[model samples]
Target chain A: MSRKISYREAMRAAMHEALTNDPRVFLMGEDVGRYGGTYAFSKGFLDEFGPERIRDTPLSELGFVGAGIGAALGGLRPIVEVMTVNFSLLALDQIVNSAALYRHMSGGQFSVPLVIRMATGAGRQLAAQHSHSLEGWYAHIPGIKVLAPATIEDARGMLAPALADPDPVVIFEHAGLFNMEGELPDDWTVGIASAKVRRAGKDVAIITYGGSLPKTLAAAEILAADGVEAEVIDLRVLRPLDTATIAAAVAKCHRVVVVDEGWRSGSLAAEVMARIFENAFWELDAPVVRVCSEEVPIPYAKHLEDAALPQPEKIVAAVKGLFA
Target chain B: MTRKTPVNQKIEHRPPPPPAGPVPWDKDFALQLLLDMLRIRRLEEKAAELYGEGKIRGFLHLYIGEEAVAVGALHALAPEDNVVATYREHGHALVRGMPMQAIMAEMYGKQEGCARGHGGSMHLFDAATRLYGGNAIVGGGLPLATGLALAAKLQGETRLTACFFGDGAVAEGAFHESLNLAALWKLPVLFCCENNLYGMGTAIERAEAQTDLCVKAASYGMPTFAVDGMDIVDVHATMQKAVAKVRKSAGPVFVEFRTYRFRAHSMFDAELYRDKAEVAAWQKCGPLHTFTARLKAKDAKGGKAKLTEKEFLELDKRVQAEVAEAVAFAEAGSWEPVEDLLKDVHTPEGTVTAAPQASTKAGRAKSPAPRSGRRSSKPTSARGRR
Candidate 1:
């Protein structure tokens, strides 16, 4: 049985479960407790976990995130919320220099079992300071796992596994996906290793994840209506990118189109294309095409924002262009 | 340019010295502290010689001049307490009980090194010693120390966290943020600042507007103190008081030790940062010699903390031998297999389950009051390479 739930509710559910089950687990972030999270993801958490466990912090990303690493080392499971990916920039030194690199640099003696959650992407016109998706920057690092939960199931399920992993895990919850409704399966088990084939087809492979997954699926539907069966692959895990699944999808489709909200220059789509060139170039019937946001600060205007993002229409056009 | 290794061959042929300060009821205890400091100094001197030989690579931030700080302060800390240190931390690791052999082997990049030879000069870690790391990034360890303190407080462990950073780290945002959080939450953390007066090339006066570091710490509502870092007596006395205060209260305390680095910042340093007169001036108050002089003066006055010059030389010889053994142990250590590179990138541990959906629970997922500022657009997808 599948039940419909919002992305925010799914994330809240995950936190509640972790706190209730594990006495060692705690949540800390700016506006996470009495303020109920920057996105209302931890609403009523203060009353439940109290200030000790449901900690509300000052606007100090580096301090709190580094503290999260410390807490993990001290045998506590800490889920640190960074408010937004843009603000996570303040804590980048801790996350990249310390948390991500600690285990590897320490020659595996120390592992940071910390989970950091942040809102990423640009769709509601938060402007340059508040909006932007830099999960790719984190994904590029070797010591940590980067996750993007495109659906409600992922938003709810990814946290537990991330916290269980002895290394640091970064979860990027797209701001646009908070209100997104989805029917999560009763027994859906989301692993941190592989990608998921959201929609199956053989004509063209539409590879995307996170905020762009829904749009790519929508575009595939439009393509099907036009007599083109476009397959859709959601790359759930970004770090050890499930290249095998991606290759299998491309092998069947022979053509690939990647959609990402990040700008075109050196984007996640670029990595996907590079992998295809390395692993499945001979099987590719057409050159890979990428549907990415315009290389501009996400504008505040609705039309401009829509034009700048990877829209379903754009994904459809890119898919059609690959065939044309 | 062709300076000798400073091994001081004259100080290597005597007997063990008597106590220097208030001798604890346990005889030979003060000797242990002296031995610890000597071990650190000898190990670092050996490290410098190896650096010259090109055997130990990377930034060799030797903890030569600051041995007494670690020797005295670590003696006052419990094994359960958390320790966070900056890059110049060979002394801290040794005094905290990380085996000298492992630390030397780590510098050699041998698999038997403390971090299995993966972390070179700047990244030593000993989980058993509760030593979080030899964090190289300036001011990076402050927040981590704060968190460890918070966890200990919550767990009712009665343990405190000691954070060691250089004067250079005072300018970083992490330092300010950590100070504020540690004070506001009243977490049990001992912020140990080794103010060496310079950040690599920049002097303290040129780097900070307010030269008073304790003042900055006091602004965060924490009790702050400044001590003579070169005097092991002052470092020990100040740290004992600071740790007690933090353990008794529910908050943090800051201690600034005004110390000097006798050696260059790294082997690569050109010595253009400061003048020779300044180095020579600080060298006159070097911890070992001054403390030895103080002991000899006390002995002349018929005090309990008495030691002959010959005995001090003997202790130095023992420490030198220990350091040589550590170096040989490192040279004999093996390299890690190249195929194991992917291991420990993430914990090979089993996965965590997904968080449940909150909307179905009705009472769990209520939206809180909206943020005050103008709202931004929803976030975009992660762009650029995965």
Candidate 2:
């Protein structure tokens, strides 16, 4: 009983299910109501769920987001959308200082139980302001959980577990993946703690997550045609990373190519490669290499933007470089 | 909307002695108000002493002159109500029912501290009393207080959330946004702006175009009240009125408590901002001395129960001894083992609600509720709080 659905629909479905089932769950963010969400994820939710549940907020990210933390503490589940990761910077204090630190600072007296979702990554020609892959920066924080949902299944499934998790969870929904069509099963509910090996091969491993997963899988197809089998690992959970699964993948393939859209200097790819080194250093057949975004603000020009990001060719090149 | 911004706004602070000579109330309750204020006055005096003795470290913000605001405002709210305070919060925590020993132990970085010493001096937290935190960031507690009020509304609870910030926080976006949100949503929030004239070094008039905080807060469409923060009677009166409106689920009320800080902003503050003359002038109307004078006045001159010198000294002696016991408690408190350093980062496994099945009454984690006046319930599916 599987049906084809877009990544956006899966996300909407997850939110819809959570809102429909639990009285505590409510969506609050700019344009989430009235405007039906900047991404149209909550298009008709305002009518279906009403404005109280499907809340429309002003251009106050820090206020509403911090309100979400308080609401959670007050004993309600709040799904706070930031519109985009770039705008999340305005609310960074509430997220990093208040939400992330509440439980620890309160000496385990309070758990935020807040889910903050924001669209991340570049591709819509939205220059520097509207586009960024800053989930890695959030992953650096200790108290909050960071999730990057790359697949339709994850987009549909991850919200429930995230809302269920006691601590603050930031879900980075790649802006490029909203229209991504894939088969979603009747049972799209999946656990949020592990990474899924999207495609497996014994020769070399190509690891990535969020928007880069499809590109890495495409690169694997290209590698397969060239008689070089590439195993693909999709890092679903960015924080509290599924190290055991990643270690097993590295041990199986012996060589790895990490792809990330964040900048090369202190990118998530760098973290993945570092973890591989620490956890599976002895299992490596060759030194791991990473393909990260070129160091520059993502440009407005399509060609320049494409060059700044990790494409299938870039992933293929990085994998071939690993084999060489 | 443009106005001439003053470079150095001279605060024409005429510390008026409270006009209401005798607040006609029960003798015990009236004495209790004085008791609470004296307790904070003495506790913080000891805290400042301990800071010098090297027993406490890391930004010990003393509530020296601002004792009236914490005591008066907090006493107005019920225990079931929520409280969010700023870094200068030992007075708020103590008055709100957090044990002075735990507060001192926290200052000593002991496991017996309210936050298990993780939060240190500026970050005391007590879930049991519903004191959300000693939020160090200026304007940070506003949104948290607003959100807590939102939860109260959503949960259909009558308890209000009392949030205390400073004049400095008025310059922050969190303050404006929180005020706007709370007003728009009509949440039950008691916004206590402890306007101690300066935000660190910058005076309110210098930093803000509109020195009138009530006007700025009223722009958000919420009712605003100004109180003589240095006067306990005014502070208590203003809070009772504001809390009455908010407690009825009327909406958020923004209050500016006009007062002054007698000390530097932090242990590190060189305090090159304000002049010594100005500080000395404000000290002339210190809350404790003036209030004590009023209470101990002759019975014919509006003092119904003239608090005799003997009674005042006995009360002072009691608080002084309590401060010493708190210091002893901190000294005897043990350090949390390094092995437990990694603990409480996340709700330890099994306490959190595992992924819910569709449409089930989210098997509530049996954790103590964050706030519980008469509004206590089994909370939500989130990880166990305490």
Candidate 3:
């Protein structure tokens, strides 16, 4: 018996299940307790989990993230939400130098089974400071896994497995997906290492993940309307990327376009293109083109902010440009 | 504060000795402690040799002169207690029960190393022994120790965390923050500051405005002590007492092991930090030989005898053999696969919750609603808002 739910509800259910099932699992972050999370994901968590587990931390990312590492070391499974990726920079030392490096550096003696969840990507009218996608940066680190969930099924299923992993894991929830509503099968457990093909087509492959999936799909719909079949592949896992699926898509489509909110320079878009080049270069009819955010700070102006991010029109144009 | 001391000595109070002089432990236990320290000494000596050979690279901070502090201090605690040490912590890891093979492998950058070769000399970690880190960042482990202690306290465990750092760590903000937090929370953490006179090349006198390490700790309302780290007996006794006090009161304690390093700070040092004469003067109080003499004296009082000069020579040969074995183990250990480079940062469970099935349905269903929030829609200009 499957039903529809919002991305926010699915995430809430996962967290609620974790807290209810595991005595050691606890949630902590800014506004996670009383204020019900910065984005309202934990609206009823404080009352449900109480202050001990549903802790609200001070505006000290380094302190709390380091504390999360400590707590993980001390035999607790901690889910630390950092509001967004932009704020996670403050705790980069703990995340990069400490958490990610702990297991391998400790001669494989210790494992930091900790999870850090944060909102990511750009969209909405929120200006430069609040907007941006940086999951690609986190994927660069070794000893840790980076995840980006673009749909409701993923929102409901990633947390439990992340909690079960023996090393540190960072989950990037695209800000654009939280309010999104969707359906869930009664039996669907999404693994963190696989990629999904949303819309199958043989002419062109549209590769994207996180917030850009919707836009990419919209562009695919437009391409289909014009009798140009475009395949849409969703990259659920960033690190240890399921390149097999990407290769399969590119191998069949013959042409590909990568849509991302990250800047074009040294971005995930570039990495995807490189993968296509490595695996399906001979199969490609044209060079891989990417529709990424403009290479500038997102502005405060509403139209400028929208203009700077990947739009449906932009993705459609990019997919069309691939044929040209 | 009440005053009663030899005025000058009052400025630097020595720790009060235990009432029973010291426990008359058997020769086996005594020799075991000595062997552990020697193993560290010889292993580090070979590391210096390897650095010279270019087989090992990076900042190789050897614990050459500071063996007794780790050896004696570690012997005082149970295996269940936690340990947090600095970059110069090969000796601590060995004594805390990390196999010499792993430590050696780690130094050699082999996958079998303590941190699986991910952390070299500066970062040794042992999960079975509860050794928390090979933390390279100055003053980084203090807060971690405090938090571990806090967790133990909250969980109703009688465990304690002993954190080791050089005197230079006193200047870092983490040191003060940890001390205050530990004291305020009454967490059971034994702050063991190895006052080796220098933090890298800078002498403690030059780096610190107030050189009294114990005084700085005492300011946080924690009980403090200063010990002669060059003397294994002093280090062992003072640590034993501090451990007892913290266990009974269940609060934090601070001890400064006034020690010295016989070698350079790292492989690159040119011996310009202090005079060779000063080094020679301190070597006279070398822990190994002097501790042997003290052990013999104590054994003689028991109507038996300690190990003879030949036994000491034999012990050194055995330690050297162990170190050699460790090096071979490290040399032969494998490297972690590049494919797995991204495995453990976060667990593999997160990909499940990312893109929901319903979201896919929603994308396929009615009008697509824009998912929007705090972050900007544009990629290039992402910054965190307060």
RMSD of each: 8.6, 5.2, 9.3
lDDT of 2 by residue, B1-386 (tens): 23465565455445555434665556577678888889988888888888899999888998889999998888899988999998999999999888999999999999999999999988988878888889999999999999998888876678899999999999999999999999999999999999998888877767888888899999988888998888888888889999998876469998999898999888889988777887888887788888888777656654346587889999989998999999999999999999999787887755642212112234532332221111111222233311
Better model by TM-score: candidate 1 vs candidate 3: 1
Runs off by more than 4 Å, candidate 2: B1-20, B301-304, B352-386
Poorest lDDT segment (10 consecutive residues) of candidate 2 chain A: A184-193
In terms of lDDT, the poorest run of 10 residues in model 1 chain B is: B368-377
Docking class of 3: incorrect
> By the lDDT metric, which is better: model 1 or model 3?
1
C-alpha TM-scores of all predictions: 0.91, 0.94, 0.80
For B318-369, candidate 1 gives per-residue lDDT tens digits of 9888898898999998988989877756655543311111122223232211
Candidate 1 residue lDDT tens string, A45-112: 89977989899999999999999988877767789999999999999999989988877777666777
lDDT of each candidate versus the true structure: 0.82, 0.85, 0.79
| TM-score, B chain alone, candidates in order | 0.83, 0.88, 0.83
Candidate number with the higher DockQ (1 or 3) = 1
Q: Which wins on DockQ, candidate 2 or candidate 3?
A: 2
B1-386, model 3: which lDDT tens digit per residue? 23333322313223222212333567898899889888988998898898888878888898887888999899999988999999999999999988888888887777777776777899888767888888998888886787677557645678899999889899986688678767876889999999987888776656677788888999999999999898787788899999999999999999999888889988888977677777877777777766776665644357654666788899999998898888888777788888876554433333321111111211322211111112111221211210
Residue by residue across A1-324, what tens digits does model 2's lDDT show?
A: 678879988788778767765778899999999999999999999998888889999899999999999998888889999999999999999999999998888888887889999999998899988879998899999999999999988887788778878889999999999999998765434677888899989999888899999988889999999999988999999998888988999999999888888999998888898999899999998999989889999999999999999999988887888767
lDDT of 3 at A251: 87
Place model 2 in a CAPRI quality band.
acceptable
Q: By DockQ, who's the top model here?
A: 2
